[model samples]
Target chain A: MSVKNLEELNPIQIDVLREIGNIGSGNAATSLSGMLSNTIDIGVPVVKTLEYEEVVDFLGGPENVVIGLLIRLSGDIKGMMMYILQSSFANVVLNTFYGKQLDDILNVDEMDKSAISEIGNIMAGSYVNAIAGLTGLTIDISPPSFCVDMVGAILSVPAIEFAQVGDRVIFIDDNFKISNDEIKSNMILIPEMESLSLLFNKLGVEI
Target chain B: MSKVINVGIADLNVALAPDILATYALGSCVGICLFDKTKSIGGLAHIMLPLSTEAANPSENKRRYADTGIAELLALMKSKGANIQAVVAKIAGGAQMFATNSSVFNIGERNVNAVKKVLESYKIPIIAEQTGENYGRTVFFDSSTGLMQVKSASKNIIVV
Candidate 1:
């Protein structure tokens, strides 16, 4: 069995991917909980196959400003992971770390950027570690590239980067909460076509 | 009460006078606004890639590439009473949102260049532009006045 594109993913294959997201985000949430020293909870992971136009609105609209951290995945499973920090989430982290809040999200200084990057690093590291452990695949991630921009612009990177293969994009949405604040940050994992096939094969799922 | 007509990513639309053509959050993608002052008609295209030739699936969608998208937009505007000789363009977006060492990630630059080349090929002069920065832009183009308002989160709004 073979899958031609992301849109061709079967129901069972989708379920497998959802489970992968579940395990990965669950591990990530635990790591975040330890780092923030707060009780972190995650909602059930959602996997959606969307068109390029729909991706922006799905991230709370195109004009929505966000902190975007991108990590390139190489080696066994090649692709990229994008971690978006919502303003509320960034505020929570900032208040916890330095007891300071950003005057404006767009004007975030280097220290704040570094802090956000570190959070992305730890969470994405744990997420990738969980996936790698489950599949026994060796994966390496590049240092995160950080940006403060509109959600539409941030998402354009992945949408254009993967446009060569297909028109549809598959994203796994993970919702996180620290105590009472519902931080709707998003972590998107987009794997290359060959890597997708390899992952399905390793998991005994027909592509 | 004029309305704002949104041209989404990989999409294009034409509007007559008194209406605004807008595209939000343009990162690496380029928004090409072609306006005919004589007719007060305008068209906008939000193109993702530089050229259609680079597309693996060339048949997918013409509006997603600079080459095909600009040509299609010109044709659309012309059909809606825009004079080809009077049509001028203003381009925006093509921002390097993420600072990376790899040239492969510089799609913003590529998109901007491709859009310029395509416009030149159609004999359309670019009247004004606010592009090639490390920030996302939301463009609101007024067909009546041929004014493009560029807005960003980190900077003051500029109209060109």
Candidate 2:
């Protein structure tokens, strides 16, 4: 059965999407808080259909954007999640952890790798788990591998089938307020549209 | 009095007196700095990709890739009256950056391998190197002293 188009998705379906985002993001925030020993506050995650160009703009004036893509089997659905973070934002997060004022606008290599990797691990694991629960599926995430320097180059890779149908994209606006510094991270979830329908059927949601 | 030159990613600068060469911000990219202690001459090349053969335009863009870069760097040093055999090398950068399930895309690992092989072909020993993992790096070489300093996630400064 062909899934209803985005325009045809009812209010309940929209609410379902928003609630799923909230649950997934909440799990991520909780995990990060436990790891850092610092109370982390997260805004309610929002779901919307956006054009590719709009998504780029929402991410800010993209200069050196890094996108991390992971595909996992969750129950009956094959979930494809994309995590995007601006290089500047990554530096801000690092500086917050250092608790030092950045005097130079230089390279970010000065920060420790363990710290950054831990951040990626926690955030991706928690967010994926939340999505799995909402869809009533079990998912095993691949270790987070990253590409840096150019967003355009990463996105151009043919291996990542991001444009495929049955893809539901959820963009997350993550803000970390620590030591009076605000750090932002973006998370995007793109579920294969066909798999999504199968997932909804498993959830007993009336199409 | 000798000169030194320091190079950064995508950009190169020269220091003539007590010549020193350096490069920073190498991830899955290689940094090759050549030092001629006797002539007090040095040169640094910070390359991003692996081969210039894949470039849309291939006309000796040293900052774009590694293979073509090493050749260009060697020629540049030779032009400066620095003998290739007398130059000692220190290399840094080429970090994993991201953890992936497949080792095939580990550009950091690839970069280190390519650099070592090229330098070996030239019979230049890598006197010092700091690479691998998911962090960034900053490298400084003082031509006057023939000293290379590497700073990264770790606090200790690696001097070569």
Candidate 3:
């Protein structure tokens, strides 16, 4: 399917998109805060369209990259959600869960199955719910699968890449500050090409 | 005296003496072991990706991505008086954790391909490898005898 250029989107469509990101991110933050019982500080979500290379650059470096994927099916909306976290920030989240400091050493197996799942469940569930609320739709969410490592490995899927290329992607960039350290997370929203048109129509916003 | 060193994703630790080079829970990431038979020195690196060129600031962080970590591990071996050319390599890890109809994010496959390509380019012959499946793996390499073992859901401590 041909992808519509962002420039082709009307102002109302852009506003709707931004509002969706803000609501979804905010809801995710709230859910995480309650789950961890800590005052989770999430920066105001910013929406943007970026290339694959640009997303990698925004991740800063390898040391801090933790990728997680969640699939959600909300009524007529079925999509995959992905998030990236820096290593140091990941440690903080881990520490919060354990209620103590984790050894500087990370156990990849344990973290992937345990910490990553819990976090993904909280964030993805909340985010999907927010979207459903805004669109007056019900969405079913699948369990989150964690991928720790490079983005290339995690995003090598042809369909995922195609959807990304065929849509006006929205990125929610935010930082989590815990114990004097700043960690960044990017929430990538890639609506299916058809879904975007449907969403715009539903919102009464012309593309 | 021999000592064992274990590396994990996002973290790398070293043990200078002849011992086991171990890493657990390798999924979609490569575990690289470098052994110097003469010095009985060994190092293991669990690298997640092929390169750090995309990272904003690539440095000596051994636990982040693959390219930079491999270089750093080799340099560390060189500094310890281990002959680079004499070092033998055995690698493991890189498992697909999820099943997707669309091969969009088959990270396990990509990781294995990247590791093999990089090692070949570096002229490091991988004498043994255990990779690519839906299960997780735990790898152990003994520098003293150059014996690498892998433990997974399907297999138990099989020598590589």
Best by DockQ: 1
Against the unseen true structure, what C-alpha lDDT does each candidate score? 0.87, 0.60, 0.64
- Say which docking band candidate 3 falls in: incorrect
Least accurate stretch of 10 residues (summed lDDT) in model 3 chain B? B54-63
Best by TM-score: 1
| TM values, all candidates | 0.96, 0.50, 0.55
Q: What is the two-chain DockQ of model 2?
A: 0.07
Q: Candidate 1 chain B — worst ten consecutive residues by lDDT sum?
A: B52-61
Better of 1 and 3 by DockQ: 1
Model 2 stretches with alpha carbons more than 4 Å out: A2-9, A62-75, A96-114, A157-160, A166-168, B1-160
User: Which segments of candidate 3 are over 4 A away from where they belong?
Assistant: A1-11, A61-65, A72-74, A100-106, A158-164, A178-181, B1-160
Q: Per DockQ, what order, best first?
A: 1, 2, 3
Q: Could you give the candidate ranking by TM-score, starting with the highest? A: 1, 3, 2
Tell me the native contact fraction for each prediction.
Answer: 0.79, 0.12, 0.04
lDDT of 3 by residue, B1-160 (tens): 6555656554554455556677755656678888877787777887766566754545355455667777788888888788878877888767675666767567667767766777777788888888887656677777777788877543456896
Judged by DockQ relative to the true structure, which candidate is superior, 1 or 2?
1
Better of 1 and 3 by lDDT: 1
lDDT of 1 by residue, A103-194 (tens): 77887889988888989998778778877887999999988999998899888888888877676766767788887988776777788889
